[model samples]
Target: MINVLKQASEGLLYMSESEYPFEVFLWDDSKQKDITPECVLQKVGLPVDTLVEVVELDSFFEVAIAEQDWHNSEEKITVKKYQHLVQVLKKYLFDLQVMRFGKINIDVYIVGKTSDEYLAGLSTKVVET
Candidate 1:
């Protein structure tokens, strides 16, 4: 609750809702692709229900975002849909951050169910631009 860093680490972010003591690491393209849609699901530990987007970064890897296509599509999609929202789709190169390998926030856009939820268990207000 304090407006201070509750925890800090080298390239790792602290999250509250984590069931396991998890550390978040950015996808190192030097060792991997910008974002493999398949690997991202494995990293998130969720199954595919709906695909929200597929972003192609300028220098890094391409990202195919499959919305958490769970059985309970209604509830889950409500929460996951906003993550892959395209402010300008099909005509632009965008920057994306690996938000826990599951969730992601595109800049200049407030996505997800709500700001509090999207920014929840996150370090910065918005991903580093």
Candidate 2:
């Protein structure tokens, strides 16, 4: 599963209004019953008191894959890359989620349950005003 994620995310950057690379991570103890904002924070070693916001997967992708200028080849490529990554994540994972921790500078986790019941996916940082 990790290998699949690596291949899907290779050379693709999450456009948080800023470009950032995605890093794959797996949490062996995360079960479907244990998926909560607090639980995720703890598993990822984030401060327990840190602010956490949850956004639906589709909502995250709506902004992430928004159309760019038609003339900018780079921007077009980026959109395509994100689209492809989204498809791969949806195809391989279940109970997908998007979590943002913090204010202007946010830690983003796009995680879901793998077939083996472990939580695995990608994490990245985004700076937003």
Candidate 3:
């Protein structure tokens, strides 16, 4: 993940259908055209018993070199090493909620700074109404 992030940190990373074999995407806000950048930053720290598990990836790729699997599925996350990132993201947003909006939802804590990166690295299109 660090290597991939490092590469993406420099510029955008694009994946073709041969790379991530995703057939289709159905978004809830397909018509929404803009996403307001919330000033709040939520940081989720390391491995919490409460977070979505980080799935075991097979070399981060499988099948004719094309894959569309949700990598972070039901796998358990161990706090042996990766606990800090999650904590930083989750706690940051939690504090942001109390300080700014007085309420923070689960989505905010999970998305963190990755929201921008996710949208950038992935090949999916956005159609914000």
Candidate 4:
């Protein structure tokens, strides 16, 4: 499944999972909002079940940097820096995929099912946080 990132804090996803169809949330004006499943599909131009995975850059890079052999103690990755890196990486990766494949067929993983099937199993009701 391709993970689509919509929020930064991990807990926010969990808190809103009971409400929205997806496992992510967006905070606006100190209120949590459901990032509609349609939005995700629109961004990737793929169906819902395509497994759009979300990357929590700060947490991800923290573990990755620690696991890597070349660890830098002087330079550390902050949330802001991580977000910048991820933005740049996504742009380049998206461009590379389009250039090499002529389309975004595979995104980090092979999609197992269409987003329609995925959304069917989710709640469509709009919830307020």
- State the lDDT at 6 in candidate 2: 95
Candidate ranking (lDDT, best to worst): 2, 4, 1, 3
Candidate 4 per-residue lDDT, tens place, 22-127, comes to 2322212221123343444544466655544443333333542343335454333433443543454343222111100112332321111123222111112222
* Decreasing TM-score order of the candidates: 2, 4, 1, 3
TM-scores for all predictions: 0.23, 0.87, 0.17, 0.25
After superposing candidate 3, which stretches have Cα over 4 Å from the reference?
1-5, 8-43, 67-129
Better of 2 and 3 by lDDT: 2
Span of 10 residues, lowest total lDDT, candidate 1: 107-116
lDDT score for candidate 2 against the true structure: 0.84
**Model 1 segments more than 4 A misplaced:** 1-23, 26-30, 54-129
Please write out the lDDT profile of model 1 over residues 3-109, one tens digit for every residue: 11123212322222331122223322223323344545454454654233443321111221234445465644433432232322211222243332224432111
Give the deviation of candidate 2 from the true structure as CA RMSD: 1.9
Off by over 4 Å in 4: 1-32, 54-57, 64-129
lDDT of each: 0.28, 0.84, 0.24, 0.30
Q: Give per-residue lDDT, candidate 1, residue 26.
A: 36
TM-score of 4: 0.25
The residue pairs found clashing in candidate 2 are none
Residue 42 of model 3, lDDT score: 18
